[model samples]
Target: MKRIVITGTSRGIGFEMVQLFAQQDCEILALSRNPKPVQELNLSNVTALPFDLASTKDLENVESFLKENWSSVDILINNAGKLVNKPFTEITAEELFSVYQTNAVGTFQLTQKVVPMMKSDGHVVSISTMGGVQGSLKFPGLSAYSSSKAAIITLTELLAEEYKESGPSFNVLALGAVKTEMLAEAFPGYEPPTTAREMASYIANFAQTGAQFYNGKLLQVSNSTP
Candidate 1:
């Protein structure tokens, strides 16, 4: 069975992705701040680990946890993230740091820890935002969140190249607005965005194939009918 590690499994896209992978019979190391209450999803192959990514100490714990449990992981999905809606001028230093700490620093630190445990030919999928791309939109009061996502895009590209010859791989999924907590915070009263299941399915497909073409690439997902 393919072993996979996914962050942020408590809710949103991360939860959906964990469910999808579990359905596919993958060995899952699911990370969340809180334990899920779904008895149906409770399975032998699934192991849920709880840790607040915001804590620097937690990063060290993550490294130790993986080493102690699974000797290797087949895929590492950086799905856990934070979002804050504050105007650029109104954003405080603490708020900005909090966002970056969770969305970028925390994600990178986890990746660094798990990368070594990834099996040969494994893949790393980093969940990013379309807002990271230039011209995506400078949504008012979302400067901090948007800029942090942009940094994730850069991190993905650089890591992909750095580990180009390594067995494990890397890619960034620059997802559009999804009906996630992050989106709700940014666009209150807006209609529901794309469902987590849809995004999860697309990510699952990418993970199964090990498609190197997407390596180091920023993939965008939209709800526009083709």
Candidate 2:
């Protein structure tokens, strides 16, 4: 069975991804700030790990876990993220840093630790937002969140190139609006065309197959056809 590591598995798309992977017989290290939800699933293949992407201390724990328990990872999904909805001018430095810490900095830190543990043909997938892409949709209140996700896109691209010869493939999934709590918080009263389950299913399938054909690419997944 494939060994998979995924972040933000407490809820939303992350939670759904864990379920899908577990159903497919993968051994999953599911990380979340609160692991109770994952633990409650009680699946033998799912190992719920408590983690807070914003916390460097928690990152240390993640590194330690990988070193002690696993020699190699087949798939790594950097799916945890933070969102801040505020006007550009009103966005505080702390708010921007918080979003960046979770979406970019923390993701990079965790990936660096896991990269060495990844198999030669391993796949690394990062979850970014469609708004992060240049010339994509622009929203008034997503300045910090969008910019942070943009950083993830750039990071993934650079890592893919840097590690091209070394082995593991890197890719970014630039997802459109999904009916997640994060989306509801950012766009109150608006219904998203896509649901978290739909996105998670796509991501789980892509995680298993996309690495064969895609690397260093930003894949845009949306409800509407481009």
Best by TM-score: 2
Off by over 4 Å in 1: 37-40, 224-226
lDDT (Cα) of model 2: 0.90
Q: Candidate 2: list runs displaced more than 4 Å.
A: 224-226
For every model shown, the clashing-pair count is 1, 0
Give me the candidate number with maximum lDDT: 2
Candidate 1 lDDT score relative to the true structure? 0.79
lDDT of 1 by residue, 1-226 (tens): 8888888888888788877888888888788777563224777878887767787777787788778877788888888887888778899999999889878988888888889887658899888877777777557787888788889889988988888886577888878767777788888877665787888888888877744556887887766311
Per-residue lDDT value at 131 in model 1: 76
